[model samples]
Target chain A: GQQVMQIPQYQHVQEGEDFTTYCNSSTTLSNIQWYKQRPGGHPVFLIQLVKSGEVKKQKRLTFQFGEAKKNSSLHITATQTTDVGTYFCAISFGNEKLTFGTGTRLTIIP
Target chain B: DAGITQSPRHKVTETGTPVTLRCHQTENHRYMYWYRQDPGHGLRLIHYSYGVKDTDKGEVSDGYSVSRSKTEDFLLTLESATSSQTSVYFCAIRVTGTETQYFGPGTRLLVL
Candidate 1:
């Protein structure tokens, strides 16, 4: 069985501050996907990383995958109120299903 | 928005009762999945179906079962509900072997 673990179970940051979350897996993954879920909302697909040591950006959010394909990170610059949510990392290992990490819950102060 | 819809937005059932949650999709996607989200446990997959009548268990499939008799519908069943099963459930669909998955609004279930 594959297991994905995420660091910083909870984080609180002031508005305009930066934040980052890390994810590590027990096994190599073919691809990794990131998701965001607002409080009391369903998980929404954010982005996916496939290549080793790949980096992608979405506006103020930057995502990076480790060279071994077993770790990933999501960093947000100048966080806003809208950025308050739980971020999850899901890994796929040549299967139809995905194993999701515990997730990092972020809160932005006013 | 991938035309994914889940029925019974909220449900409250007593323990030992049988409950079935329905997931309907208009996108005609071949891959459908059921996941449960709790406070500490982010989102854990219960089961997934790749095609009609073809299904596989996920990490947390002990107390749950799934059926996919048609391409548009996937059903998750709890034979005898327990208090531990209280959580928010999500239904997601995607193109076969694709990374993009569209999730439903989600169903909150409480078992007493």
Candidate 2:
């Protein structure tokens, strides 16, 4: 069995502040994917990191994978009003299914 | 965006009732999954089907059943629904073996 957890279950920040959420897994993963879910929307795939110590950026959002492939992080710089949503990190170990973390709910203050 | 849709976007039923949720996908992917989302639990996989008539259980499969007789359709059934079964359910299709999944709009069920 595999387990994944995310830190800071809920976070509220000003529009211009920065935000970061950490994800840790009980077992090593073959790859990790990040998803975003708006208030009333479904989860949407954002990015994926397969290699250890890998980092990728999408505009203001940055994703990183640990060297052990058991942890990852997502950082958003200068959050905007539209950034209010829940971010989840999902991990998989060479399986067709993915184990999703508890998720971090972010609220952007306007 | 992947042409995935869930029937009865919102549903409300009483205890001891039978309910079914349908997931339709136009992607024609070989893999389809059903997951439940609650306040603290992110997304727990209930079941998944790799192909027509091929299915497997997941971490939280109890009290839930799934059927995939066709590649484009997957159905989740609850024989005897309870309040605990009230949660938002999502159906996803695997885009690749790498585990990239695209989710449907979601179905919110309320059991009273």
Candidate 3:
């Protein structure tokens, strides 16, 4: 089984500030997926990075996959109040089931 | 959002009772999954099904069992529920030809 660790179990930032969360793995991954779960809601898929050193952006959010394919990051610029939620990175070693990171909880102060 | 629905959005039951949660999806995806979300633990996979009557256990499979009778239906059963099993349950479906998973609204269960 693969283990993925996410940094900063919890984070709080003033609205309009920047926020970033990192997900690290001990071994190379086939692919990595990011998800966001609002308070009292189910997780929603945000994005997926499959190639080494891949970077993708959606609006103000940027996602990066390390060249080694063992790490990934999500950065939000000028975050809005809607950005408040828990961010999780998921990986599947060689199976259909996914192993999720502990996740980083983000709070926005409006 | 995917056409995934979970039955009994919320439930309250006593210990030692058998509880079953149903996951229905109209997407007709071949792969379906069951996960439990807690405070510190993000989402732990309990079970998943690749096709009808084809299922496998996950990291946290103990005390839980699953069955996929049809392509669109997956069921998770707790033979004897415990207080520790009281958590938010989510059902997800993986799109064909891709690894993307769409989750249902989720089921909140409380065991006393």
Candidate 4:
């Protein structure tokens, strides 16, 4: 009964440009996880944000959780060609199952 | 890199056929999950197993079933596959005491 909606279903940017994807949930979340799926590859766990208003960064990628814990965002600075893939935001409501967002497919122009 | 492997990386079958996908893990995790990925629908959970012989349905479990007979093996079966079942299926395992889930390589099934 939970829904996660992601914005900019598909995005294409120049090789050196930046990109951002937003994830909004209908209800507050206990925790949110970000995953990256490369072309022809499986989804890999990137990071998890449990505390409200938390921010985490990995290399050029930055992840932020909204203060209300109902939304999150992933921003990539100076994207590279290798950054082409779909980024998904997943949330769990104290259960074993995770509800994933529709996902944002990112493409980088070389 | 969780030592998770899926059998038959790619499969093509006809409608109404019975198909089964296997997920093998070396981590011996307690929780296993099966999810289907479509074009617009990111990853919809089909089923998940908490332990051996303990399973539950998920958001999209109508036509899919799963079994975890052993701690390292999980199987997803499609009794009567349909064209709508043509999609990539991913199997994941949740690390003990953590919410992080590691996914397998995935199985691409095409129902014609």
| Model 3 whole-model lDDT (C-alpha atoms) | 0.95
Q: TM-score of the B chain in model 1?
A: 0.97
Better of 1 and 2 by DockQ: 2
Q: Write the per-residue lDDT of candidate 2 for residues B1-112, one digit (tens) a residue.
A: 6789999899999999999999999978999999999999999999999999999999999999999999999999999999999999999999954579999999999999
Give me the overall lDDT of model 1: 0.92
Can you write out model 4's per-residue Cα lDDT over A14-107, one digit (the tens) per residue?
9999999999997899999999999999999999999999999999999999999999999999999999999999999997888899999999
- TM-scores, all candidates, are 0.96, 0.98, 0.98, 0.98
Question: What does candidate 3's lDDT look like per residue over A74-99, in tens digits?
Answer: 99999899999999999986578789
How does residue B48 of candidate 1 score in lDDT? 92
lDDT of 2 at B54: 98
Worst 10 residues of 4 chain A by lDDT: A94-103
**Residue-by-residue lDDT tens digits, candidate 1, A6-39:** 9999999999999999999877889899999998
Q: Which 10 residues in a row give candidate 1 chain B its minimum summed lDDT? A: B94-103
Q: List the lowest-lDDT window of 10 residues for candidate 2 chain B.
A: B93-102
Q: lDDT by residue for model 2 over A1-110, one digit each (tens)?
A: 88888998999999999999999987788889999999999999999999999999999999999999999999999999888999999988787889999899999888
Q: What lDDT tens digits, residue by residue, belong to model 1 across residues B1-112?
A: 6888898999999999999999999978999999999988888899999899999998899999999999999999999999999999999997655867889999999999
Docking class for model 4 is high
Candidate 1 global Cα RMSD:
1.1
DockQ of 4: 0.93
